[model samples]
Target chain A: MKLGRHAFGDDEALMMAIVNRTPDSFFDKGATWAEDAAFARVAEVVAQGAEIVDIGGIKAAPGVEISAAEEKARVVDFVARVRDSYPGLVISVDTWRAEVGAAVCAAGADVLNDAWGGADPELVDVAAEYDAAIICTHTGGVTPRTRPYRIDYDDVVAAAIADTVAYASRALSAGVARESIVIDPAHDFGKNTFHSLEITRRLDEMVATGWPVLVSLSNKDFVGETLGREVGDRLLGTLAATSVCALAGARIYRVHQVPETRQTVDMVWSIAGRRPPLRAIRGLQ
Target chain B: MKALVPGTLALLPSYASIEDPVAPLRAACLDAVGRLGPRVRIVSSAATGGSGARVGAALVAAGGGTVVESGETGVLVVGNGSATRTEKAPGHLDERAAAFDEALRASFAGVDLELAEELWADAACLRDLPPLADAEVLYDDAPYGVQYWVAVWA
Candidate 1:
């Protein structure tokens, strides 16, 4: 798969570390809200062997409304700084606004991770304009930043597959390179715990669609709710969910912890026979 | 021409890891096997289709040679020393393993088959080969608690 200037083999599973620039983001909770703190996060994730750094301005939860200009202000310069320092890392700006997407792309972002599932229709056009990869997500047609209330689906996996595929087709029609488009089942974006759980269980169906699948299961509400744990204590639960998605052949993982997720994915990848052991001489020798 | 390579299954491609644990030994074995003619006969005590025989076939194929039952130009012997050289060895530590291997290093004849079997040494097919003193000893070590040697007599 190609992410702007970077190309990877089909069998590779990538770790996209989450770097929040929002003061009120759910997980970090303003820990990296300052520009320098956010920059430090980029460096940390790069050092931890992350293939991509996904920077986000506004919190996914509904709170203070951030303007497109504010979003651009939060991430565009930060994206340029990360790009200049780490030329090999894939920079992904998590935004659904076409304006924010275009600005970050100009600042050398390789991917536009629209966590809201194409709330802004022109996001894909901006991605095509910059020749950047776009993440098409399934959100059950809910409005951006709103939690799912009484959201019902006959088959959550089927709905996710259909919606994400259609969005991917839309991105393709907008001149985005076929290999540069990725589909995601945006866990907990417009999904409750059950919907997210079902999506994780049937992720192979989405993988079978031939588009590389990206999973954003990083300490989300679904895992916390499933395990009856708070956000800060949900890492083990998140990793368990990550293993399920990885075994189903998810190509990209948007994660909060890079090293743990990388180990989990690599172990699952080897178990699935997509990768060989590092130095296996136990009994063969 | 004659070559000797250990019957470790790690030499087979199917048992390979991303970072090879038997790289030096594999290189030595392949280099020795390549000096043999296009068709070579394999002499091994391992049962047919066993890991030892498979490793021998793979090395021969990798060296641009084929295994043949008749009309062979050279012979390839698959055997190894004791597998109980250390506490972590497959058969665990054996007090007599090092002395037995040292004796075989001096010459291949007069091997005690019962003692070799007790120590988990695959030396049954090694009895007829010339001593290491008369051949080019490419490798001789026990890296993973299992003694192995790669030698060629031309």
Candidate 2:
């Protein structure tokens, strides 16, 4: 798959580490809200072997409304600093606004991770203009930043496939490179616990759509509600969901913990016969 | 010409690892096998299509040679010493394994079949061959708690 200037093999599973620039993001809770702290977080994830860093200025949940100018202020310069320092890493900006998308792309972002599914129709055009990759997610027609009050689907996996595939085709029609387009079943975005769980169980259908599948199951509310755990305690549940997706052939993982998720994916990849053991001579010898 | 190599399953390509655990042994085995001429005959107690015979065939093919039943240019012997050299060995440490292997290393003739079987050694087909002192010993070590030797006689 091509993420702007970077091209990766089809068999490789990538870890996209989360670098929050928001002061009220759910998981980090303003830990990396300061620009310097966010830069340090980028350095840490890079040292831990992450291939991509997803920088998000606005929190996903409903909170203080951030304008496009304010969102650009939070992420544009920071994206430039990260771009200048780490040329080999893929920079993905998580926003649904075309204005923020264009600004971050000018500052050297490689991917636009539209977590709210295509709320802005012009975001794909901006991706095409900058020659950047776009992540097309399934949000069940929910508006940007709105919670799923009583969302129901005839079949959650089918709905995810239909919506994400339509978005991917729209991106392709807008002149985005076919290889640069990816589909994601956005966990907990327009999904409750049951919807998210069904999506996880049937992720292979999304994988079978022939566009590379990306899963954002990184300590989300679905995991917390499933295991009766708080946000900080949802890592194990997240990893369990990650294993299911990995076995179903999810290509990219947007995660908060780089090393732990990488280990989980590598282990599951080997189990699925997509990877070989590092050095195996136990019974053969 | 003739060559001898341990019939460890690790030598097969199907059992290979990314970082080969038997790299040194594999190199020595390939070097010895390459000198055994074009058409070779494999001698092993393993079933005709078994893993040991497969390793022998792979080595012959890798050396740009073929295995034939008749009119062979050289003989390739597939067998190994005791597998009970240490506590973690497949046979789990037989007290008499070391002495039996030491004696067999000096000469392949007059092997005690009963003791060889007890020690989990594949020595039945190792009989009537020239002693190790008469060949070029490319490798002689017991890695992975299993004794292995790569030797060539010209």
Candidate 3:
């Protein structure tokens, strides 16, 4: 699979570390809102061995509206700065606006992480124009930044597969490279706790779709509710969910705790026979 | 020509890890096997289906050498000293492991098979072999609390 300038082999798994530029994000609220602080976060994740850094200017939940101009102001220059600093890092701008996507791509962003599914139809066009990668997420047709209030699906897994695959097709038709397109089952976007659990259980079906699957299960609401833990305390639960997805062949992990999540995925990946152990001796010795 | 390598299964390609646990040992084995020319015979304690011959075969193949049933070019012996070097070792700590390996380091011609078996030593194959007095010792340490050696006699 290809992520912008980097091409990965089939057996590889990637960690896309979340570097928030928003002050109102539920997790790490305002910690990295300052540009310098965000840059420092990028440095930390890079040191922790993350292959990609996903920068988002706005929070996912409903809040004061952020215009395309404001989103561009938040991420465009920052993307350029990160690009100048880390030449090998895969820089992804998380926005649903085609305008902001285009601006960030021009400023050196490699991926457009449209976490709200395909709310903005022109987002794919922006990706195609810049030769950037796109993340086709399954948000169940919800408007951007809106919470899933009593959202129900007969089979959440099937809906995710249908929606993300269709979105991927749309991106492919829009002239995006097939290898650069990725599918994400956006957990808890339009999913209740039960729905999120089922999607996690059946994530292998999404992998079977033959697109590189990206899972954004990083400290999300599903883990919080499932284990009766609040935002700051959900890392263990998040890693538990991550193990399930990693074993089922999810190629990319959008994560908050880079080192911990990487360890979990590497361990599970080895257990699934996709990766070799780091060093093994015991009985063989 | 004759060479000796540890019978550790980790030397086999099928048991390999991303970070090789036996890299130095493997290098020594391959260098010795390569010097043995194109065809070599294997001497190992493990039965036909066991990992001893498999490890020897893999090293031989990697070194561009083939195994021969008769009229062999060289001999590849697979054996090790003891698995009870330390408390954390596979057989736990045995007080006699260090001295037993020391004796084999001096000479392998007169090893007591019953004592070797009791200590979990795979040196039964090395018992009838010539002394190591003239052999070049390539490797002689136990990184994982198990004794291993890679030596060659030319």
DockQ of each: 0.86, 0.78, 0.86
The predicted structure with the larger lDDT, 1 or 3, is: 1
Best-first order by TM-score: 1, 3, 2
TM-score of each prediction: 0.98, 0.95, 0.97
Candidate 2, superposed: residue stretches over 4 Å from native: B47-49
User: Tens digits of per-residue lDDT for model 3 on B9-100?
Assistant: 88888788999988898888888888887899999986324678888999888888899987898999998888789998888889999999
In model 1, the runs with Cα more than 4 Å from the true position are B47-49
Q: Report the TM-score of candidate 1, chain A only.
A: 0.99
The 10 consecutive residues of candidate 1 chain A with the worst lDDT sum are: A276-285
- Return the candidate ranking by DockQ, descending: 3, 1, 2
Q: What is the TM-score of chain B alone in each candidate?
A: 0.96, 0.95, 0.94
- Runs in model 3 lying further than 4 Å from the true structure: B47-49
Every model: iRMSD: 0.7, 0.9, 0.8
Candidate 3 chain B minimal-lDDT segment of 10 residues: B45-54
Q: How accurate is candidate 3 locally (lDDT)?
A: 0.91
Docking model 2 quality class: medium
Ranking by lDDT: 2, 1, 3
Return the lDDT, model 3, position A105.
92
Give the 10-residue window scoring lowest on summed lDDT in candidate 1 chain B: B46-55
Error of 3 at A69 (Å): 0.9
Docking quality band of candidate 1, CAPRI definitions? high
TM-score of 3: 0.97
The TM-score obtained by model 1 is: 0.98
